[model samples]
Target chain A: MRHVATNNRDPEPKPLSEPVFLILTSLADQPRHGYALLRDIQDISNGRVALSTGTLYGALRRLLEEDWIERFKQKDTSRDKQAYQLTSEGRRQLRLEVERMRQLARVAGARMKESEG
Target chain B: MRQTSMTILWLYPAEYREAFGPEIVDTIAQRAGEACLQGLAAYAAFAAGEFAGLLLGALREWTTKWTARDGYMSPPDFAVEAADVPDLQRRIQQLIRGMEFAIANHDFPKARLYSDRERIMRARLDRLLSAGNLYQSR
Candidate 1:
């Protein structure tokens, strides 16, 4: 195996945690409020991961701070029903993370094939 | 039980609470019956996780500020939104009540908790006031 290095000053983006990845995935389609996100994320992950209120809000705060997501109020809803949507930056990051996972899966699949052969 | 859960929300840092408090409380209240339906162990675990998550969130907020993370340079506009000032003032009043109650009961630790949240709320107000000064000068 060989490795190559480039003269980029910035580090490569890392994979997101399961909850964060799932949150972004859920929001990829449409904006959601806190409880809606909780429900959607559970559905998306086959009920394997259920985010507590504190954890979900904490991730939301970080995402807002990172400019990866944005909060907005809908006219039809009250303040407590404020919804969040993914930013362009968030979408880009989500794509990158999905690609990273895909690549890893490919490698693992190939390794399995080689062992079977 | 609902009021007690709302108080558990106070365990979070004031900044976090201010930003998402109502929604979180609403979410918990909406789901409380279901959690009860799920059985005691499940509810206990969820409560435990919520407290732990609050601690983790506070640590994260402190660390991110200490490290001066990106997108944290400018405080959010709502940080000083005029609409929030009254709410913040009301919260400060409540915190004082809490502190007084704690002290009356000789609960030093609980008093400290109220004191700490009050300090945080005041600091946020101070920052908003200072920002107002700059806005006025401009």
Candidate 2:
């Protein structure tokens, strides 16, 4: 898998774990609970990544712990299901990641185009 | 009103309903009830059962994750279990002890036994966590 990161003088940012990155991207639109988030990701990816229940929830746990995202609300009527929203920090991190990937793609595009010439 | 027996829960178990809130429940209830009104015998049963089955399955998955030392299971090999166990031999003994508890109550439902097994699982899980990233090691 191709990894992209910001080449800031301070330090190279770590690659977002693929599942974590994709999850964040999916959430950029609106708040999503766990299962809905899973569906959205599945739909967006066209089934390229079918997150197993374990992987989905595990990523959620880490993402919550890191303050990348947070529990937006708990469903009282529902049995123990909770919804998550991205934190401000999470949004910023996601933006940074997207930028990094864009940069990589731009460079790749130029190189590929040049090769044809 | 006719005694409408609707298996409207075409949606079934609810995924514990935590994430979805009332919306999913309403969906299930409405669907199940509608099925009853329509007199769809097999469809209602299948839908209701599925609703329960899927929700429970998801819940089971959720519980397993919370209870597990890792999100996914790897074999209880030396590398993963060894680090946390400290003395692998002794740790294995502890796991056997836990497994004994897990399998000890061979009464009825293995599903029911999970709570009991959880204790042992939790202990072993703790050891696994302390042990190190077994996958990376290999």
Candidate 3:
């Protein structure tokens, strides 16, 4: 197995990039392939942002490196074509990101609604 | 002929995948048998690039201040030079040539590997790339 040195020993780390934060979160619900994940992010963002190939693969690698996500593709098939899925760590990270977003939304909503009224 | 390698190269996202769509991946299993030198290069290059991109992308996001940018300016002016994606086809083709030459002549070929290195370098680019100014949105 190829190995990359770990940057730090933290057990639970935050998503390093927006792409990864989004990618891992996307799979929090279910596993997906390269294109499918990109489409889902686009759908949710309502086209405000789209993940390019570089951004998509970039986050996928980081998530894998941190052991946050595991490669789901079958390497035994002897082909480089591979797929990936969220690991337990990845799921936890996704949950944190979701809650963080939720909290921010809640605060923003109260302020905006109160001001309008 | 090396043209057959094109089938293998086509399996990767940019050259064949983006151009031909998902059809290439379906056929990759059938055509990958003893593929020529160029095809092997394409496969390795794609994987290497994918690995590099995944690692660096996460690192950048982990470091960037996504929330801090909110309500700061008119629009986020992110740096484009950092956003550029290297040409995958050229690197893959070169890698194939390097390996083929090394195998046929029995020596290390540095050029192809160098090309691969350059592609990988951009992923880990050290400078901070700001997302231009700032833009507000929900």
Candidate 4:
């Protein structure tokens, strides 16, 4: 067995990048393949964000490394059409991010209302 | 266009290429097909952005390969019982053998699949061994 370093730990959870966040959101509903992820992300972002294949795969690799997403064999799909889905940990992280944004938006709205009044 | 993209994919690191090359190619081909339906200009624009993205992504993957310690490759945080060691070891061995066979046959995608499974099993094995050592020290 290799000398496994048990001391290394994950640091604090930083905010996910737009691409990462979108990718997670795309997979939140169900598993998707590479092309599917690209289309879904575009739809979710209302065509504002068009992820290149390279960008999509880069984020996928990072997420897989983090265990936030997992690859699973999907029926009726070719071997090359690898599909990915969000894990429980990924779902939790996405929820946290949504909550954070919601709170920020609420505060901003309240501040604007006070100024208007 | 796909041939061009396939050529560009070679710029990525071997591990990354083996893992994602086909999927990237398939996605690019699909996008290209969609762009073709719009017009020549649209297809050209898509090609330009796609190629540039592939170049930058290759650079990023190389940087990650050199600098990042993959979390999955590290020792796991979960505990493992003594009895689970043998089963984990067996699975790891099976996965490694499968990976090797796939590699030998030039089935990189299949090899990558085996490698991913093997990595998880290896992590579990490490946890079990670590747990045993901790027990011995006590």
What DockQ do you compute for every candidate structure? 0.19, 0.02, 0.06, 0.25
lDDT (10s digit) by residue, model 3, range A1-117:
011223333565553566776777677777776666766887777767665454665455445544566544444455644456775656766777677779879999999999999
* Cα lDDT tens digits for candidate 4, A14-56: 7889999999999999999899999999998999999989999
Model 2 chain B weakest lDDT span, ten residues long: B1-10
- Pairs that collide in candidate 1 are none
TM-score for chain A, candidates 1 onward in order: 0.87, 0.83, 0.71, 0.86
A31-81: candidate 2 lDDT, tens digit per residue: 876667767888889879756443565567556544567554455564544
Native contact fraction per model = 0.41, 0.00, 0.15, 0.56
**Model 4 misplaced regions, further than 4 Å:** A1-12, A77-80, B69-138
TM-score of chain B of each: 0.43, 0.28, 0.23, 0.54
Give the residue spans of candidate 3 off by over 4 A: A1-16, A74-81, B1-138
Full-model lDDT, candidate 1 = 0.70
lDDT of 3 at B111: 37
Local accuracy of candidate 1 as per-residue lDDT tens digits, B1-138: 457656766765566667777887777776666777899998787767766665676677667656752223233323433335566777778778877887789877667656655664665556555746743532
- Please give fnat for model 1: 0.41
Off by over 4 Å in 2: A1-10, A74-81, B1-138
Q: Which stretches of candidate 1 lie over 4 Å from their true place?
A: A1-11, A75-80, B62-74, B77-138
